[model samples]
Target chain A: MKKGTMTLTALLACVTLAGSALAFGLGDAIGGAAKVWEKKDAVVKAGKAIRKGTQDLTPSEEHFIGRSVAATILARYKRLNDPKRTDYVNRVGLYLTRFSDRPETFGGYHFLLLDAPNEVNAFAAPGGFIFVTSGLLAKVKSEEELAAVLAHEIAHVTLRHGLEAIKSSNLTSAFTIIGTEAVKEYSGSQLASLTEAFSGSIDDIVNKMVMSGYSQSQEFDADAEAMAIAFRAGYDPAGLTGFLTSLRDAAKGAPDTGFFKTHPPAGERLTKATSVAKQKKLTGAAAPARDKRFGGYKL
Target chain B: MNKSFWTVCGALLATAAVAWAASTVTVSVKQTSVRSDRQFFAPTVATAKYQDKLAVSGQKGDWYEVTVNGKKGYVHASAVGGGAGKKEGSSIFDDDSKEPGKEDVALAGKGFNPQVEKEYKSKNPKLDFAAVDAMEKITVSDAALATFASQGNLSPKGGN
Candidate 1:
């Protein structure tokens, strides 16, 4: 009897995941397959499925969630507001995004320089809202490193990493109402329910972004993706390795918030990046035009 | 059958076959660039707006070769929602094939959009959307970005 119930639970779980039908990359579903998100009160949930949990949210919905997350982050960290620097970063970041796995997002990619010079953190909200801290800018020795950093965050967005942070239970509520009918507007109760789910979605993401770090595997995945994206965009993969090497020493006096607190560099991550860097041929002239332009921007 | 009658039938069938072979796709995103090349940053040949029907052919990975208003170009498959005779294959990324009258209802401003943002903002006054608005304005033109990449010797690989 217990075996039959177990089989029944697995069947229903598969049915729920199949209902999501994400469009971009199906392979992600496999990696995320173990991530079967159950209803908040669902007692019989297990495994690690990725995009399926948040599959009900449209690209536009993802954008709104990201926009709010950006709002929250911007509220905490003010913009530096130097057009030249901001424009430069945007160009570089946007250019790298073209080479990332998922390039064209609903709202497209946008990058901003946060004013916190002491916090060496960067963030990539869903739907391509990227934030780079002045402190992170100060840390990079060259434009390649900057590209590497941006590429890492782009990987997060391209991989829908932020969306993955939405707790499955929250998704259960959001998915329950979306697309069930072709109504132009949700009824008041439905809207309220969705809004609560929306509010919780942001809470889950903000908590992950501000308090805890991504799973070490996710960080590693981002690092590996950063190398591929940077190399494709003609920046050397070494940039990531160089930055990771520097990050190892940063944990000593790391601040309470931002990259250091959330992303404590692991030795294994750096070693993996270093090996990958060695395999990728240095793609472009690093010193002359690139680093020279890097000098033009003020941290 | 007589030769002339047979010839007429062949002509009609040929024309029907041509029409049947032709596939159609509708742009599903707010906008998608029809590029000279399949590369995302390749030069934009044209822009397809939401619900714009396109004559399409060939598929290289996720991009569809499309002809828009006498111009030939390629659009990423994700940019278009449905193919000819394909109705059931829709994903969250797609808001495909709505009824004609209902098209306007789901048009660019549907789902969690500006209205939701406004509502959410009224409730949470401390969140700085004004900053996000200002941040969204930060943009680089294609010409400027191309120049930035070429000048810096950075944008060398995949981008056109």
Candidate 2:
């Protein structure tokens, strides 16, 4: 009777150990497999979804955003607060706007001449607003050069640069709203100051928010667009290079301030523009003289 | 156990962490007082034109270059104290960070006045803001020197 009892105990112990080993091993293996599979599935699904969404943005959507942003910019620059010279600006701006790829009516581009004559500058806001400062005009030699500058700004708009800038940034909703509101609410001086100080040491933050400029690729693209527009409108492509070179030379003497610091060096810009003109096979076309309609305003 | 856990944790944080943003540099006016007392060496009658050159670049004294008419001349360093390179408040704009709408241009008027509107009108009081709006229509050639070689306005012989 004692021998039978001992044998029974040993058999039970062996059975318990084997059962536990099988259960733990199988359970862990299955769990680990499931976790990895889930991660892989998620990644594939996410990538496909992203591809689908990008495909959804049609060219019309691009144009729609482009027009709204441009109109808001033009309205802001109008400084409707100053009514005395509005017609003169409006007429010239309207003429230029008429020449753009998108007519001014599609969110017509307007020009604003700031009263500061000593400080020279101009810009093209996305959509169709072009701003030229009296200060900047004082520096220009003629209508064609002026037109070349305007055409460059116009290309930035037609190419949807501003909207593209916003879309590419990884901004939080709050900052984005602030930027949008700032664009609409800030007056020119405010905008100017905001932009002026943007180039300070905190470069890392500014690049993320405003995207200070187009990619080297975008700059090239805009140059092509500007040249095409100018060439078609009877303006010479070489004028763009000449204007860029002259600005480069003048920059040496001008107070080391503002736009020149932000823009590409004059030499690099001229080289690229000239190369493009050559590639397009455009030759010896003459642009207008500085003294014609534009000569009277020089200091 | 310890090494694997730390490695996994690091990978998770790295994947989840937010990316960095772009930044700008702040260039301030070095002082509140313009260096007005400074003097220029005028060999003869102190001509106002040619002043940007006379202000020796590294001189410790404050030298102001003033433009009268089309000519640029040097000013009494003391009178210039209100304006030249004085340290104003620090402001920032982006240099080269890759985000969107990042091109913020800070326009500093003749002085550091924050309001470009008032500054605009004050500078050109003769023309109302609207008439001056036509100024944007002016070309670089219209304002600066032009290469008239392309345009018929200058005979090939007459242009510089």
Candidate 3:
């Protein structure tokens, strides 16, 4: 009877151990299923977010895009390599930046004079990179006029008009790919696709800035904002009107290239800028000393 | 064993919760003045240098209220990274140790950066990256700008 009882006890112990092992296996299976479900849910959510246009380009992304765009612009036009003139333009641009809405960006503000003669145009790339043609520089007679032009370009940078010029479809694809990738390092194909998207986006912006130009409304808005920025900076807001009027007059004599081609009609811009200046009651004037310094830089 | 696991998880969650309550931002510009108010014309209260870390306490429009060295001040959102001190992502079971996303990677200067620029240059040899490089080297000091403003009768001191 004692032997039988001991065997029975040993059998019960084995059964208990087996039962616990089965339960542990079941628990692990459930945990693994839950983990798979969680990962799937995250991916679905990320996809949905991309579909909803919730992804916005970060500042650093904008900086990179701007660098590429700037490179493209530089490819077309050589930079005017005058240290004195560059320094002067930078000083004027930097002073306006202090009073502008966005005083700083990821890469900081830079002003470059493009060596394009008889092309009255100014371009503002993303990340506070600005380009002014020598033609526009030669056209402005006073420091306030230069300030006004720089302020307009600065407004474009601050409002991200250049970035906005990128095609929406390109941005969506780029953002979607970026959002869906969980790993920092992309595979060979992934990097290829990303580079393709990036180049396409850059092309879109270049086309808008150099070829098609921004919309009428965007130019009008920049003009309006320029007036406000110049007023706040103590520069005569009428300087924008003065610059636009000069452009209109110059258009009659010169070929319709650069500014005349890329921007809206100067008469419309001048009218709008004039109205804004009047509404704001801007009465500042260009100091003679300021103009003297501006004149010191030779074209 | 399960009890200890849950305890550790709970502690981590609590720490993350606290960290979320007060976000931190790093200054990205060379030097940014912490204004006494949100507007640009407001008085300068303190100066924050590049890479200076500040604990964000509140926000008003484009400016963020931050504390550095036990002093309260406001810095424009553009002057710091993580624009306005916004937290990127958060979830109960989210793994913070995972590799960063594209946005974070770009901000950290990892992917699609100088390396990519070099690659792009190799492909498009006509692009004038040397001029862009020179353009990037230009720097303007605050003192110089102030003097320029004063000389030109511009804003802040020119009595706009």
Candidate 4:
């Protein structure tokens, strides 16, 4: 195998092993150890190709992807039926999308407000699809902070992180099992599990495949991208660091829960994000007094 | 390998994705005037014609052609849930619901729920509730708020 493929294979192995250790018994790891590294190159190659294709997708193509991901997510948590929150999220998402590198003139980014007020999470997918919970929105102090979150999700789509991971893997079997709909259904943690099983070892490649995340470096890149997007949209870049710091602080005492457990530790992410913000001169940016008009949402 | 192959596969995948994505109902709104002097309107309203359940339509107007027990007549937008499609970029009704109605003077002294009232008081928490409640208790006439109100669906939430 080529040197790059070998290295990726080892990384994939570690990620899969880590997830396996978390979910299954240590005994199973010994049994499935040999099979992990096989076909590693093909999977990585496929992931790279998919990422490239997804990135190259046109505005309409991206929107189509967004709609699928958004629908699947909305269907899973059917309890939050508030249209006011839904409409508000969509309006804000669309507004942010207007400032993205690629804006959809035909069909702008559509948002679905998940009524899962307790789910402290939000996401953006290809094709301008986005979502946020009332729970997450409730914690946001300003519109700029909210915009910062949206911009980060937007960066994921622009970077084609999910598609790239899928492309690089020999996903014929997995695709058949989960399908694209499954991608929407699987939470970040669940994706992390899958990555461990597929990746021979664990590292960046496994991180991308299972958890649908970029590495620490990749995440920092995304943060920088988010800052630029927010700044360009006339929002303060400090919003990115503010929200990231809040997430880091919130994760400190909480149980090992949700996506944070799968990717890099929140503290490191927060530090890197702050450094990136400082490097970009975001610290000097003024906080604009703005209110998000989600008045009817009762927390 | 060629353009045709790529186009064909792309279209197929896109169509499949679109089909899977479009589960939610699409509602549209139209504006109409009401005859009542205490004319009221919600921020938005969505109504389905009595028989045509599949073809649901939304209207953000001062008066909506609402069907109550199959009897069609104009109802105050505020009486029903108000402002369905109008809140998005498009406003079908030119009339602003913010304009006061006759005899429906704003109430003084905020007591409806200090917390909710405080947050949403600017939207005129002082409703002519005597007149509005006389017509109907604080009901969500707008689609978004109605959506919020209907979360538990069985309970009534007081305050903004």
Candidate 5:
């Protein structure tokens, strides 16, 4: 009887020891899993940080911003319904794009004719959307002059002038919000604030392009770039000077509005554009064939 | 423990591999000519169209030397995306009816994107998106551009 009791006690002791060992083994496995998850979490966090902290907006973001801006402008002016004329503008615009430093945007370059007969203005939105008022088109005497106008607008897009017009403080705040909200989803309030920042950014650009116009320096830079681009595209660089000369003549006849209000004095612009053309020795003449095509389409 | 360590190592290695493989660029424009030299006025050797994947064998300033269909030439860097056909970011405001979930919100936080545009559109319903859509549909073919350039006496002759 004493041996039997001793054997039973030994068996119970073995069972308790084995059970505790199994429990310890399970705990180790769980701990290992937790460590792996922690490492993965860290990696994801780092990835998010990198994405949020990026300084410049990506091509996709630029595209969306430009699209919204284009929509806003279209809201104000009716698009010209003449497909033939519109196609002509696009062809010239696309040809010049080949010579631009940045020829491609996310949505590609598009040219539209606005039916603002009295407004002699051309505007470029981000993402390569360009608009020229019919009044400006009518003022252009030759195809090369039209190319010059389109090239100027294209220069604005390539140089990101519209994006630069946004207030620095607004951009900083928006970027900060983006960086802080690193998670895949934002709360309701966070989204609301982001939307507000976006609206402010759009407002800044609109005010600059429409109400106030870009600074004198920016306009001059675009004019210089346009001359270079038009020269490269085999158009007469003097086309810009000719267009400005016409504007100067017209401004003398009528009150300053639209293009005159938005851009620097035509006299100053003509001098600058002519100097640039002369310095580059871009003396190419407008092709007769291009003029023929230009004449086929009635503005 | 060993399995987890291998998994983590594998994930890291994959990320590194992607960075290393970024030498390839895909044409993003509708079409662009690959020139014998970096300059736009240089002789043309071949032409690449949209989504045509090319290996970026070399780079000079803003131009990239690409190999397409066994032929090597220089293409402007602006004509192609830096990496393969990979696009960054996720769809944030793809569908306006549904409330965006966490994943969508995260992507939207990347920058001002389609989601923000949707919200802006909602507030300003008068904006003419239809006209914008029509404008986006307008595309000039490369052949037409080439013809125009040649007739207009632009550089890089059409045949070459």
Candidate 6:
């Protein structure tokens, strides 16, 4: 109860401070301040929304945040050294991005193969720093299936799922710090606070990507978008269904650990994804060439 | 006071609002290519960076057709935000949204940039950023990508 009032007070303060920034419009007053003030009532509501953490981070910011998360994940896992496999995975991942809504990310999309031969999962750090484990790669039986998995990871990135994991309080504090006008450089105190918030944000995202997993709804959304992207990219939508079917079989009686532990039951995911495929009429046949390449790149 | 006068006033305000919604856009990405065409594989005509405001003359799909330094090109909509702000490289501000606080990272270069990363890295030496750098280095060239697509019998036309 005490925390609730404190939050409200802090939020009100955020609104107040944000309003003051409008006075000078932060050194670059290209947009008319007069026009801005004319809609002060609406602006305040927007400020309230921002103060409540309903804000979007720029692509550059997401890139920086993603790098740290990628670094953290790297600290926990080892990268695969097979240049052939790594190059092959990157080629597939990058090709998929050209067909995603957010094809062009601030730092561009990069795919890293993690040498987790026993861990069947993938991680899409905010921007496009995506990591796919070797065990998961072993599960894929075709180029279309591989594309299906990558399309899902790319969907996660394009959807900004990791940022959704950031705590709103941390975002509010960061907004307060950077949304100031005389902010050429972070003062020592400001830097400390901002760093603390930034560090916390990273922790939040990494926790979601690792250890625990995104909510079931998030997973389903990714699956839906993945199928859409796969269909648009000229791959058989059955690729997603096939991949999900494989997981459902592999996960039967599997211990509640690793991928199976963090994600929804593959059975449930497959059901919903198949339904979506039917609705979208997502029909296509795997090209013989694609199957051949998949056989060649088989790890 | 009269109906025609009120109509004229309303028309002017509506025109102003439309102009305001699509005038100036600030760069949101660290850097984005202003391409000859609205596709990633298109040739880059100009380069814009974080906080650099560009004139958003028009929009094509998700790509914003912008002119910076009189050179016309296209920037992805995700690479920019805000409106009605003139930027000469150094200026960074957001007055685009009628709602205050719509743009949070205009001070991004000063915000969570490399400097912050350096600080964070120093504090967290246990993190393996070297591996991250190695992962980042795994890039696909246009030639390699084209070949991969061709070999796979895939023809990716692009998306949102």
lDDT of each: 0.68, 0.40, 0.69, 0.42, 0.70, 0.74
Q: Over the stretch B47-126, how does candidate 2's per-residue lDDT look in tens digits?
A: 32211112211112233333333434333322211111111111111112111111111111211122423433344344
Give candidate 4 misplaced runs (Cα > 4 Å): A1-63, A105-107, A169-212, A283-289, A292-298, B1-160
Which predicted model would earn the best DockQ? 6
The C-alpha local distance difference test score for the whole of candidate 6 amounts to 0.74
Looking at candidate 1, what is the lDDT of residue A90? 93
Candidate 2 docking band: incorrect
- For model 3, the docking class works out as incorrect
Question: Which 10-residue window in model 1 chain B sums to the lowest lDDT?
Answer: B95-104
Per-residue lDDT of candidate 6, residues B1-160 (tens digit)? 3456546545544544445434566666557788888776677788997767777655557777779778998887656643112111212224434212135333345456677788788899999988888777778875677677777787653463
Taking chain B only, the TM-score of every model is 0.60, 0.20, 0.51, 0.21, 0.46, 0.63
Chain A, model 6: TM: 0.83
Indicate the residue-level lDDT of B6 in model 1. Answer: 47
Which residue segments of model 3 deviate by more than 4 Å? Answer: A1-55, B1-23, B26-53, B57-62, B69-73, B81-112, B157-160
Q: What would the per-residue lDDT of candidate 6 be over residues A176-195, giving only the tens digit for each residue? A: 77665245467788888888
What are the runs in model 6 whose C-alpha is more than 4 Å off?
Answer: A1-51, B1-22, B68-71, B82-95, B98-105, B157-160
Of all true interface contacts, what fraction is found in model 6? 0.41
Q: For model 6, state the Cα shift of residue A106 in Å.
A: 2.0
Candidate 3 lDDT, A53-89, residue by residue in tens: 2125555666777788899999999898778888999
Instruction: In angstroms, give how far residue A192 of model 4 lies from its true place.
Output: 28
- Going through the candidates in order, their DockQ values are 0.17, 0.02, 0.17, 0.01, 0.16, 0.29
Give each model a TM-score.
Answer: 0.77, 0.41, 0.75, 0.43, 0.73, 0.79
Best by TM-score: 6
TM-score of chain A of 2: 0.56
lDDT of 5 by residue, A1-299 (tens): 58668656655654454334332212222236775575456444532433322125555566777788899999999998878889999999988887877766667899999999988999998879899889888889888899899999998987788888778767676666666665544566766777787888888888899988988889999999888888877788888998899988888978767888888998998988888788877677877887887788646
